[model samples]
Target: MAETLLQDPRTKYPVPPFPKQHQDVPGRQSAMQPVPDCGEDSYVGSGKLTGRRAVITGGDSGIGRAVAIAYAREGADVLISYLDEHDDAESTAQIVRDAGRRCVLVSGDIQEQVHCQAIVQRAVDELGGVDILVNNAAFQMSHKDLQDFSAQELERTFRTNVFATFFLTQAAAPHMAPGSSVINTASINADKPNATLVAYAATKGALQNLTGGLAQLLAEKGIRVNCVAPGPVWTPLIPSTMDAEKASKFGEQVPFKRPAQPAELAAAYVMLASEGASYMSGATVAVTGGVPLI
Candidate 1:
């Protein structure tokens, strides 16, 4: 038998205690000190999602971008929805096109129900139909005190992180046929709440609950709903939302000394979106670097 090569997870990627850095909200992955490895070169697909059409929110960078690349290589045409990150979005689109799949870009605020609906409509009109819907876009800000959170800030966080998922799913459901799948990008914060990220954590908890309820609701239609709960991942969101000191030390708390690269999380999203997950609905697959979610 040919020997299988195994790489140790702890040292597979760069370890933290990284240099201090920062970017504005909805950070650009290109500017990070160690730009996240979103599997631009390494992921090799086996046609798990052949001929499928997918819509990915926040597909410009981070986990979303990684999933888009994987799906494209796996023979799926993708529609990427993001905020005003044209450069990043273009880069992702190019990669998808390089994989010989169609890539459509939609830029707007998902907090608006109309925009969410439009995103789905665009996919149906452009990609032919939507077989996979990935609600991966989110907003987060670090605040030490709950009192520091303002009414507008709280509303924006919930609207972007929680409400948009419902709006997008509701819009896409009618257009999605049986055997379609919906994958929500949840977080470890849902189980082990982060004091400084109370609002974001609360939104993720709601997503997990929403996943279970929606899974049951959609089961009758042969649609599966699931979520991926990730721990510390080295994405632009860390340097942008966290203090420089905190960002430098990100992921040290996990059992794996370093944070996961966006590439590391792509497989989970692909698995949930593929037909193999036919029996896997309402499942919360934790990719938390050894952190138990219970």
Candidate 2:
């Protein structure tokens, strides 16, 4: 018998400081030096979410894209919400359609409450109804010094990262029946704040709190609200926001010495959305690769 060689995810090597690269805020996947792995080739769905509908914000690329692909493969219709990343969004849509599922692309700034509400409405109208809601979209900027952070940036960060979560959930809640799940993308920053990501960190803290409170509020209604707190994940946000030097060392601080590939997160999102997590709510699943959320 021949032995099969399998990649050991635990020993995946760290990415060295990448070649200096930058994109205007909201980066494109095509421009990335090493394209992110969104489980396009690797993940094989087991029909965990068959006959379901999911609405994922930031589904254009990175973890959002990974989750969208996973959900589609699991037999769910997906509505992907993105901010002006038309090409990336189309690419993701194609992947979902390729998976034998329906994919709807809604492009707009999630910062607006109206836009967030519209995301849920479109899902109901198009995908039928929302059974899974993943608030996976976020915005961040690196500012080492407090003074360097602008007021405009502060407001934008909160609006996009925090407010949108509330808006979308409020819009989606009434339609969600018992056994539906809501998964928000929190960050390790909620536990260990990075000095440069103050605003983004603050918003993550807020999200975790919202996740907990809503879990309690929705318990009787049978909706589960949870979150994933990831540490340094290699995504377009790194190169687009950090200077080359910083981006290269992005995942070094973790004991694993490398950021998680986007594909690595797909299982956690799927598990939370599936029926297996029916009894789980208000939990923060830390997928931080070796980083402690303590």
Report the number of the highest-lDDT candidate.
Answer: 1
**Model 2 lDDT tens row, 1-294:** 889798665565446566667788788887887778888998999999999999999999999999999999999999999999999999999999999999999999999999999999999999899999999999999988999899999999999999999999999999999999999999999999999999999999999999999999989899999999998888888888888788767887777767888999999999999989889999999999777777
Question: What tens digits encode model 1's per-residue C-alpha lDDT throughout 95-159?
Answer: 99999999999999999999999999999999888999999999999999889888898899899
Q: Total clashes, candidate 1?
A: 0
Hey, what RMSD does candidate 2 come out at? 1.3
lDDT of 2: 0.92
lDDT of 1 at 137: 94
Clash statistics: count for each candidate:
0, 1
Candidate 1, which segments miss by more than 4 Å at Cα?
1-4
- State which candidate has the highest TM-score: 1
Query: Which residue runs of candidate 2 sit more than 4 Å off their true CA positions?
Result: 1-6, 10-14
